[model samples]
Target: MDTQKIPSPTLTLPKSLTGIQGLDEITGGGIPKGRPTLVCGSAGCGKTLFAMEFLVHGAMLYDEPGVFFAFEETEKDLAINVVSLGYDLDKLVAEKKIVLDHIHIERKEIEETGEYDLEGLFIRLNYAIDSIGAKRVVLDTIETLFSGLPNPLILRSELRRLFRWLKEKGVTAIVTGERGEGTLTRQGLEEYVSDCVIVLDHRVTEQSSTRRLRIVKYRGSTHGTNEYPFIIEENGFSVLPITSIGLDHTVLSERISSGIPRLDTMLDNKGYYRGSIVLVSGTAGVGKSSLAACFSDAACARGEQVLYFALEESPQQIMRNMRSIGIDLDQWEKRGLLMFHAKRPTFYGLESYLTAMHKAVNDFKPRVVVIDPLSSFIIGTNQFEAKSMIMRMVDFLKINPITVFMTHLTTGVNDFTGIDISSLIDTWLLLRDIEIGGERNRGMYILKSRGMAHSNQIREFRLTEHGVELLDVYVGPEGVLTGSSRITKEAQEKAGQLLRSQEIENKQLALERKRKAINAQIDFLKAEFDAEEVETLNDIELNKLRENLLLQDRIDMARNRKGDIITNKNSINKARGNIAKS
Candidate 1:
């Protein structure tokens, strides 16, 4: 009869501003409620963006008003900077959902007194918050205070006071600071804002710039410690948190055709999986774009919207080229099933491109996306950054369950130059121009198709007025043809052999039909001769009849035998040739 005492349960928490996509899972809902978060970073590390996004999202998504105080940029510049990200700061200000206050603290414009404190900042922030009833506050680049006030001791004390004041105000705040060499910030602000610390980094690896965000420490809460990759897109920043989802898990059982029946056959009796990433890698002038367009046209024909991002070629150029290949992309575009985004890889930073891509995905909500020649993006970035960008892109695509087609340019027949993106793809199709004998020919082969059995043989491909046609599998002494030389020789041999066989078969079938008709005429002549009156036949008539019947029988038998022999010989030769080649 002893009763056990029940322990009190921990209180469940509310949602917080994750500052990233898919980051709330790691933080158990968000940062602690109503406390300041410190975001410290070097130049161009996106600390300002992180803090701005938090406030913007809070105002827009959670129905909480926010206040943004900038010490460096003017309110106009901040509004313009976030405009591309789909944040209408002007409208938000009008609606009283958010307030932006820019404090111009120019050292040359004003002289600081000895008893100067952040009283003005406190007053401005207090007025903005009370005016808008803001639940979130952000001070972008609070380090600008140091630029105006040269004394570090006073700045540190002021920072501590600012944190305490923000807590007293009970508004969750983000204070951004510049990173120092050894310390977190040049003014040691990290010590003052000890509740939460986040570090943003922008580094160049292998000539590519990558942005990463890390949680240095979160007081009274658990947070992810690893540096998560993030991209600044039109809709704001998208942080990529690497989860442990297994790659081998079964995808959707549905299949989609590659637009070419022959190519589909090469894949399998079925086709590519619904949500698979297809990589088409080959040398220059190998028609990767045409292949991608063909696939796109097929999808469009099936009523699926496609988003095609051409990094190297303009949309008009792609449309003209595809038209030359007999693919009418213009019609699809007019029908609103195909959208093209053509831009230079170096037009903006990698994060900007990522952001643009993100915006396109959200706006279009396409079923399939194609990025022509992913290698072009590798020019400004190092190998590691390129790899990371590609990985994040793939992960984002996977989450959306959208089919992606990427093309890469290789250097040689078997040599992959620059960054190798094959590892991130689910299916790899290698197209090459093989040289055989004295002519050049095109060949295509599927190097690998994960989770499916595909043809291992290299098949010849040809571009015609109708479209791309896949020729028979290349069977030669040097195995399959690869370059232009090999392809030419294989094509010539195959064409000759096919023509010769068809000629012989045609001759045999024609002879067989002629022989059967002759046999019928001979039988009829014999019957007439046998049925004629036996007593009164003239010698010339009988002799003529017998001679005609004999001639017809002889012709029929010889022709039929010739047809059979020719047919058998052709079949045997073809079998022997195949065996010999094998």
Candidate 2:
């Protein structure tokens, strides 16, 4: 029998999920397994919070215990500070799922105790890991030991050795450091932790503050390279991964009403698509808020939720204003279908504004979201940031498959602004104050609605007690007519037209009566002349007949007298013979 030697099975490292939603996504699965990661950031940049979330989410979500060794903050201070973030460290510690230890190295203690390597720190970390069976470890602000201990030569050597030991022990760990002027970490710890490095920055530009994070390098894995904006709020650290998604989201075929029937008709009698982004840009006093409220009214009417992000008005103010126009947002709020998140754009940078909106949208999960007058952000110090944030929000809402109606206030007299993102909008409603001769009227038109044949005619809209009312298109003395003036002007013109028509009718009737009278007189004269001529001709013919009869009688009498004389003379001689012959 021949004995064969089997090759030793190969073991590759497995990644340790950070449990940070955005961090895991950007890191492509989290940090490399059983390897140390470097997290360097400037002061007050939320490094400790990021690390703590990593541990807490791991322990809670994945059931992987973690150890948090604080080199800068004490265990008590860490526990107190994170309480506001809703993380109960003591509870986790009591359950034997987490371990919190504070390391304090005083400069005076270093002189009294003489030089020593960080060998004790290795032993302590291993003990804590074994006690809780933690799969993760965090050494927060580990660079502080170098400053406090003041034995740079020996401490640097041991710090390098400690990283190697942690790796060989097969426990995933995170080391945090303050960012140096030139190097990534203050003590260049990034050079030692060769697995992954993340950079956090808290920058203030033009009096607006923002927190950003970027992955400088990932030795064996791919990661998102762009700087991501994050927020540190009650829910702990949340990184907004500005990831670009392809047009792969599902497009709903359902239609939604904009609450104005006229506007709906303008949109092919179907309103807007179920997740389309509708932009309403207009001048001041142009009923932008009224339109947005109309949409909210429509949503609430359908028993769907609506989240209204009001940047210019408080909830009470918006409710009062909309109530005056017949939209009862208050009633919807009582019904628990409407939510309002009001904030001043000036109070924070554009990023903070986006964070608030993101959180509100997530919590409410409404079918509709309204950002009333996104122009408020544009008026602040950061114009570019405002536009970028708005675009990102539009993308997010579209992905949520919720209908969006964002109002933008134009500057000067224009009904549009340079900040108008036309391409990103599925429907753009351009509203304006049709000002002429001291009167201002509201008019709206669809600049563009993709995939829909919308009305091009500018329909005049009026803010009434019955909500938004869209009037028919009428080009009167004003460009578009509305209110009593339109009615009065139309009535006066109709009356003038009626008067002119009646005058023409009267003149035609009078001419017809006169023509009939003249024709009757001509007929009577012609009848009289014909009767007289017939009587005269009849009398002359009768007289001529009587004369001809008398002439015939005279001729007969002369012939008879001549014949009788001859017959009498002849009769004497031939009386005997004529008597026999007769």
By lDDT, who's the top model here? 2
Candidate 1 lDDT, tens digit per residue, 1-582?
545754333544343665557556556566666888888999888887888888888888888899999988889999998887778999999999999989886678876567667787788889999998999999988888878876778777878888899989988888899999899998788878888888888887654567888889887666788887777765567666655223544478788999888899888867788889998888999889888998899999999999999999888999988888788899999999999998866786676787778778889999899999888777644565567677777777776888999898887888474676666778889998877566677789898899888998787887776778887755667676544555577678889999999999999999999999999999999888786755346665677667656655654675676766465666555544644543
**What's model 1's TM-score?**
0.67
Looking at model 2, residue 318 earns an lDDT score of 89
Q: Whole-model lDDT, candidate 2?
A: 0.83
Write model 2 residue lDDT over 37-80, tens digit each, in one string.
Answer: 98889999998998898899889988889999999889899999
Q: lDDT of all the models against the reference?
A: 0.80, 0.83
Report the lDDT of model 2 for residue 135.
86
Clash count, one per candidate: 19, 0
521 in model 2: Cα distance from truth in Å? 33
- How many angstroms is residue 337 displaced in model 2 relative to the true structure, after the best TM-score fit? 4.6
Measured by C-alpha RMSD in angstroms, how accurate is candidate 2?
13.6
